[model samples]
Target: MSYGWLDDDTTISTDLKTTKETPFYEPIVNNFETGGYNPSVSYHYNPDVTQYHYGVRHPMKPFRLMLTDHLVIAYKLYEQMDIYKPRRATKEELLEFHSDDYVKFLETVTPENATKLAQTLKKFNIGDDCPVFDGMYDYCQIYAGASLDASRKLISGMSDIAINWSGGLHHAKKHEPSGFCYVNDIVLSILDLLRVHPRVLYIDIDLHHGDGVQEAFYLTDRVMTVSFHKYNGEFFPGTGNHDETGLSKGKHFTLNVPLQDGIDDESYTRLFKSIMEPVIANFKPTAIVQQCGADSLGCDRLGCFNLNIKAHGECVKFIKSFGIPMLVVGGGGYTPRNVSRLWCYETGIMTNMKLNHKLPDELPFRNFFQPDYSLHPNLGDRLDNKNTKKYLENLKNQLLENLRYMKGAPSVAMQEIPPDLQNLTTDEEQAIIDKLNSESSYDEYLENERYWINEKDQARKHELVE
Candidate 1:
C-alpha cells in the first residue's frame, strides 16, 4: 500500500512493545452474567455503508462510519452492547414522510440518468450537494433502516439507549434533499417514537442547522426540536434562528440555540445544560433523538467551532445522563478521521464503559492520527470565540421566557394496557368490518391453504379443483 499523507501523520512508536489490547472497558452484564444485571442497549450497524461514496472531495464520507466501527471494535465497545444488523427500510416506511413522487424519483434516479433528468435534479436539488451515485437509494435505506431499528428498540422498551451512527441525515425535507442528506432518517425515527412516546425531544449539535427535522414536526406539540448550530453569515441551509419557535399548537415547542464561531467546551457545555435542564423539566419527554455531528470539532475542515473531541462528547454524555430512551446518530462530520474518533468515543460513552485513553495497538486507523498519538488531540482555540457569554445568557433567557407558552408536559392520549380491538362488538361495527373483509376478499385470496389462490378467479378455482 502506498504511504499517503495519512501515513505521514502517524508518529512511529520506537518501542514496538504493545500495551493491553482491550482498554478498561466494562463489559455489559448479559443473561449469563453472575447477577444478571444487564444494561439495556441495542446497537444498529450495516457494513454495506462503506461500499458507497459521495463524489470526490464532497466532504461527506461513508468510510468514516466503517472506520468508526473499526475503532469501536478495537476498543471492545461491542461487547458491552447488543449488536444487530439493521433491516432494510421498506418503501412504505420511506413513504411515511416523503412524497410519492419524491420517493419515485429517488428510487429510480441513477448516476447515468442524473444529467438526463435535469428537471428532476433541480426539483429535488440533487446535483453536486445531493448527487446521484451508485447505491444512493440503498445507502439511504440502510441508514434509515438503522435509525428506524433504533427507534423500534426505544419504542418496544427493548433498549434504553440505541445507537445508529450511519443515521442523522437531518437536511432532507419531505419532498426535497439538501446538504448531502438524501433522506431524513431522523424524522422517520421520530415519527416511530411518537407512536409510543407522548413527548419526544430532538437535540441536534451539528455545525449546520437541522432545518429538515425542525420543519417536519414544526406544528406538532408532541415532539420538540432543539438545534445548536453556527448561525452566522454564509452558512448553508441557514434557518435555525432563535425566534423560529413552533407555530399554532406547537408554539414554543421548537428551540434553536444559534451560536457564532469558536464555541468551546466550557461555553458550549454551560449553554447546553442551561437550555436542556429546563427543556427536560418542562417538556418531560419520554424519549430523545440526539444528532451528534462531529463536524463542530475544532479541527474539522468545514466547521468553525473550536470544540475538541471531549467537548463534543460532553453533549452526548449529558443527553445520556437523562436515562431516557434515546436514538443517537451521526450527522455532518467533514473530517472523516476526526468524525470516526468522535463517534467511536461517544459509542464507548453510551455503553457506560470507562475506556482507557490509550489507542489500541491494532487500530485500523492508527496511521490517521497526527504527530500526537493520543486519543485526546490538541485542537485548542484554533479560532476566536464569537459567542460571548452575555449574548449566550440572553439567548437562554429568551428561551426560558418563550417557554411560558407551554404550561406543562406535552400531551398524547394514553394507550390502553391491552388495546380494545374487540370494542367494536356492536352489530353495525361487525357488519362494516365483515363487509369490508368480504369486499377485500375480491382483491385477496381467502383460505387456510399452503399458498394463497385467487378466490375470485373462477377459471383458476376450476383448475385448482383436481
Candidate 2:
C-alpha cells in the first residue's frame, strides 16, 4: 500500500546533494529598483501537503505543489513576488460550499472508522480517485484554506494576482466528493468573492470539466462559469456539455466548450480567445477565478490535450490583460514532473518575467524533465492532434452561437439567506450576533467582513518599497 518511491525524500534525492552544487539553483535577486516597479502578486503555498498520500501510485500527487514551489524558488520567483505559507481552512469556511453533513463526515471519519460509515463513503465517492487515507481531511482543509485566503486577498484589493498551487479542487459536489476533489475549493473561493463583487467569473482550463463549480452556481446569474475541457461523455465525471447552460434566472450564464482529444496550442489559443473575448465583454464580471490545471498539456499521463507549458500559461496572461482582480489556482495535473514545470513557468508569467529555461543540473526534480535539460523543454505534439482545424472551428462556431443567447444580465435580486440557516452550512458566530442584537440593531446589522473592507495583508515587500 505504501508508495514511498513516488513521494519520499530518499527516492527523490539519494545523495542529499544540495542545490548549491548546481549553478541554476543559485538565486538571482531581481530588484524592481532597476525598473522602478514590480507588479503586485501574492502566492499561497503549504509544504506540509506532500506528507499525505493516497495509499497507491496515484496521479494526484500532493508533492507536485512542492515541486512547483521549489522550482519557482530555484528561478528566484519568490524574491519578485509576495509569498506566504497559508493557514489551513476552517470547518466554517468550508461550509460555505460543502454541505454541513458532508463536512461533519469528513471531520469525524477516520481510516479506522471509515468502514463503519461505509454508506457515507459510498455516497461521497470517497475511494479510488479520492481515497480515505490518513489525514485526508487535513489535506483537503490545508489546500482549501490557501485558496480561500487568496480569494480574500484579491477581494481586499491587496493583490492583483494571487496564486495558490494548493487549490482548484473543482469537481467536488455540495453534498459529496467527486472526481479527485473532496472539497471544491474553487466553489468556496468563488462564494467568498460573490460577497464583495456583484458578478464573478469562474474559468477552468483543466482537462476535465469543472462540474462542482458549474453545479454550485447553475441556478444563479451572480457567477458566470466558463470551462474549456475535453468533454467525452464516458470521460471522468462527464458533465460539461455545450447546451447545459444555466437554468431559470441563470440562463446563458454558463459556457462549456467541449474540445476533442489532442487539441494543439494554436487551436486552443484561438478557441480560448474567441470564446473568452465575448464572455468577458458580455458577462462583464468584476472579478475572476482561474483554474490553471497543467493536466491539459500534451505529455500528461491521463490528459490528451496537446498544449505546451507556454500555451497553458498564455491563458493566464490573456485573463490578466483584462485588468480584473484574479485568483489563479492549480487543479488536475496528473503528470507530476510536467505539473512542476508548467506551474513554475506560469509563476514567471504572473510576475511578468520570462525566466531562463536552461536549467542547471542542481535543480531538485530536474531529472523529471530529462534528455534536454531545459525548463521549457519542447514536449511537442506527442498526442496525434486528433482535433483538426474544422473540429476546432465547429466548436468555436457553436460557442459563438450559444453566447448569442446571453445578452442581458440576470436581474434576480440577491437572495437574503441568513448566514445561519436550518439544514444549511450555518456560521455559528453569525447566530450569536443575531441573538445579541436588538430589533433596531438587527435592522442595521451589516453582514460580511466589514472590518476588512479597507484592510489588507501586511505585505513584507522589498527594501526598495521601504
Candidate 3:
C-alpha cells in the first residue's frame, strides 16, 4: 500500500516562491542603506548559458548542465536544513584509487601530447568513448576532488551520506580509460573507504554494466560489486555476465543482474527490492556505494531500458532505508533536461529533504525550455499509472529469483570513526571558528569599502567655461 521507505511527511508545496512580490522585491529593498537590513546578506546566483539549453547541439553539454542544475537545487534545499556542504577532494585522497602512472599521464595530457595520444587510442582506449578533450585533465581533477570530498565526509562522520552527482565514472579502467570516464572516482572512493572499513558493497543500477569498478575489485573479498544493467550482448566495453563471479576469495562476491532491453519500472523495483534487500541483509556490509545513473530512464539516447523517474526515486528511497553511512555517486545520463530533474528529485527522496519546486527567476536554460513548477511537463500529473502494480509484481519476481542464487557471507562490521572528528583538538576547533569569523569579517570589510571605477562618474562635471 505504502511506497518503499519514504513517509507522507516527505511531500512539500511545489511553489518556489511563497508569493509573486516576495521573489523580486524583498532582496533589493533590504539593501544595507535601508533600515530593514539584516545582519548578513548573501545571494546565490545561477548562471544562464547558451550551451546548457535543452536542444544544445553538443551531445554532452546538456547532460553536464543537467548534473549542475540538480546539484545546485540540492545545495539550496539542504542549505536551509544546514545538512551537508560540498568540498574539493585532495590530491593525497586521489592516489588511493588511481595508479601513479595513470595519474601522471592525466596531468601531462596537453595539446601536444593529446594529438600524439589520439594516435595511441588502442593503447589507452582514450579516443574510443573517453576522448581526450582540451580540458580533460581539469575535468578529471574536479571530479576526483568531488569524489574525494564525499569519501572524506563519510570517513569524518560529518554526515551519514555524501553524494557527488558528478563523480561516478564507473567505466574507466585503472590504466586505460573507457566509456566517457577518465579516472574512476567510484573506485577511488571505495579504496579510500577500505582504509576504514574492511568490506564495502558497490551497487550500480546504470543501464550499462559497471565494468571498471567490478574489474578493480574482481579478486578481492573485501569489496562486493553488484550491478544490474542491460546485458543484450557486449553493448559497450562488454563485461559483466551473471556467471562471472569473483575469483579466489572473491568467489560469489561479484553479482551481476543482466536484464533484457525494454525492462520497465515495475520489473526494476521488484528485482531491486527482492535481490538487494536480502543480499545486503545477509552480507551486512559496513557501508554502501550506490551509483544513480539517469540513463536507466526511458527516452535516454544511450540507455536501453524504459524506467520512469518515479521508479528511479523508489530505488534511491529503498537504498536510504538501509541507514548506513554511504557514498552516492552520479553516473550516465544523456537526456539533459529530464535527467537533471530525475537526479534532483532523487536527492530529495534519499536525504528526506524537501523540494522548493520554485523556478529560479532566471534559470540558465530558461530561454531554451519552458519552465513549469514541476521539472518536466509529462511528469507533472500526479495520477498513478495503471501498469504500476503489474510492474511491481514483475520486479518482485525477478528479485526473488536473484536472491536465491546469492550465498550469505560472514558479516564483518567495522566501526569507522572519521579522521576529522577523531583528530580535531580544541585548539584546532577554535582556530577553525576564528578563521570562519575572520573570513566573514573580511567579506563585510570588502562589501563596505566600495571603489569607484571613475571618480568623474561619481560627480557630474559640467564645464560652464566651455
Stretches off by above 4 angstroms in model 1 are: 1-18, 21-39, 415-466
- Off by more than 4 A, model 3: 1-18, 21-58, 62-67, 70-75, 80-92, 117-121, 354-362, 367-373, 376-407, 411-466
Tell how far residue 177 is off in model 3, in angstroms: 0.5
- Residue-wise C-alpha lDDT for candidate 2, range 295-329, written one tens digit per residue: 89988889888888888888887887777888999
Q: What TM-score does structure 2 among the candidates reach?
A: 0.81
Model 1: worst 10 consecutive residues (lDDT sum): 416-425
How far does residue 205 in candidate 3 sit from its true spot (Å)? 1.2
By TM-score, the better pick of 1 and 3 is 1
CA lDDT, candidate 1, residue 36: 40
> Tens digit of lDDT per residue, candidate 1, span 22-140?
24455433344333433488889999988999888688889999889988898788877899997888788899899999999989999887778988788888777887898899998
Model 3: colliding residue pairs: 16-358, 48-364, 89-145, 155-418, 266-391, 270-395, 270-396, 271-395
| lDDT-superior candidate, 1 or 2 | 1
